[model samples]
Target: MANKKSTKTPAKAKKSDKKPGLIARGKAYMASVRSEMKRVVWPTKNELVNYTVAVCASLIVVGVSIAVLDLVISEGLVLFASLRG
Candidate 1:
């Protein structure tokens, strides 16, 4: 294998590859975030209320279903144990 010549020395390459300072990076990140936020389609108050209600209703239904199943299984196990005794 032939030795390849590098145009930029290690020190020069490291300097050129150096990242921006913390504050500069933070500012750039915040600017990008602000621009992205501007593009978001936010829900109206009425829509938010509707969505909240729907989510609550769904949780209640699933919660009740799980609770009922748990109760049935527990009671069945207790009955089976009593029968065994």
Candidate 2:
């Protein structure tokens, strides 16, 4: 059989491959977040209100539709049970 090469690196090489400490990584992450936030285009007050209203209206319509469907299905099951009795 052919000889297998050693997978282990020297102690000095292992030290060079070590990653940044937790505190250094955390600081770098916060710096990136601050930089990205500066590039954001936040919505105006009027646009924010309009978006909120639209979302609320959609929720109300969906809720009503589901309530109606539930009522119909419940009534159907009741009628079927009465007929089976």
Error of 1 at 63 (Å): 1.1
Model 2: what TM-score? 0.78
For each candidate in turn, the TM-score is 0.78, 0.78
**Per-residue lDDT of candidate 1, residues 1-85 (tens digit):** 7998887756534457779999999999999999999999999999999999999999999999999999999989989889645
Using TM-score as the measure, the top candidate is: 2
Question: Which digits, one per residue and each the tens of the lDDT, describe model 2 over residues 26-70?
Answer: 999999999999999999999999999999999999999999999
Score each candidate by Cα lDDT. 0.93, 0.93
**Candidate 1 — what's its lDDT?**
0.93
**Candidate 1 backbone collisions, by pair:** none
Off by over 4 Å in 1: 1-14, 83-85
